[model samples]
Target: MAVRNADISVRRGEVIAITGQSGSGKSSLLYCLAGVLPVARGEVRFDGRVLGALDDEELSALRRERFGFVFQYGELLPELTVEENTALPLRLAGQRKGEALATAGAVLSRLGLGELRQRRPSQVSGGQSQRVAVARALVHQPAVVFADEPTGSLDSANATAVLEEFLTLARSQGTAVVLVTHDADVAGRADTHYRMRDGMLAPFTRDAS
Candidate 1:
């Protein structure tokens, strides 16, 4: 079993961090909670509804409308400009292109990418690309964001920059965040911390300053 007997609850607007070594089930737990993976024997709830009870279309709607995601690498479509990439979620949700692009532009500006909005992923630095990924994730004003090793591909400085901006925006907007990483420094920024080992999760006490 990848994860067993773990009970995790996240309050609205809270930031939670999960840390563990590779193959320790941290990411598995995240996937289960995010409804990206089916649970074999447990319940995953969101907004008071059991995720497993939801049909595939319901689950898909939930993900598209309420949740955002960021991965280790910035997963941007190479052909799209930063603005276009950031506006994708809104577009998928049936927003008019002009309106979606406008919202995307505002978010990119908020992330200090106002000048780079027209650039494609290939034209930007890794950090900038990651920041754009973040912009895309937040453009829809998702209630929660799931980040899996979000800073893994960046250098120290870029990682720090991207994370700072990400948390700042999430906090300002009261968006909950679930961040999975193996880095202590990254986890330190969360309001709550947990460590996964041997397919189990337990609270780990540490100053979150």
Candidate 2:
């Protein structure tokens, strides 16, 4: 198979969906865009900067300062409470521990997770854990957020709830959201949808007739 290239320009406050079949390279594309994967033959850009131009240290800094991520599984630290887990990024960014914990509390409140702030990940439901994950992703107020199959493991109701929360929060906060998923219902909620096939991306359209 030939290597493929895809580019997307997302405005602040917009949500973009990336959809593709298995083996179509959606995950690889996301990694490249996020600067987590080295670009050997092509370039990825974000906010006018070429991702491939940054060294690993620079890229790590950029990722921490500008990007947030939500994965399919809620990767909360096993030993941390909800508040601590949500506050990790802020703490890493040098916020004072007290301030970071306070900020985390506020975000958790916004996500309806306030009551679970002291609970460990093992004590929460999957949906609650995912909401905590979302809080962690946004606590630093990143310019862009990338979610890879964020709701993939949830039941329909839980997935819908998570997607709705993500879209609402991102739009209200003017954060650009790029999500990769295989589900049409999830893709349908995006402002722009693209399908990855044969290593390239194309606009996704439905037959109106």
Taken over the whole model, the C-alpha lDDT of each candidate is 0.93, 0.88
Candidate 2 per-residue C-alpha lDDT over 12-46 given as tens digits, one digit per residue, 9 for 90 to 100: 88899989887788887787778887767877888
Q: Model 1, stretches more than 4 Å misplaced?
A: 206-209
**Model 2, runs deviating above 4 Å:** 1-3, 207-209
lDDT of 1 by residue, 167-205 (tens): 999988889999999889999999999998888999985
Candidate 2 differs from the real structure by a C-alpha RMSD in angstroms, to one decimal, of 1.9
Error of 1 at 96 (Å): 0.5
Lowest summed lDDT across 10 adjacent residues in model 1 is found at 200-209
Best by TM-score: 1
- On a 0 to 100 scale, what is the lDDT of residue 77 in model 2? 99
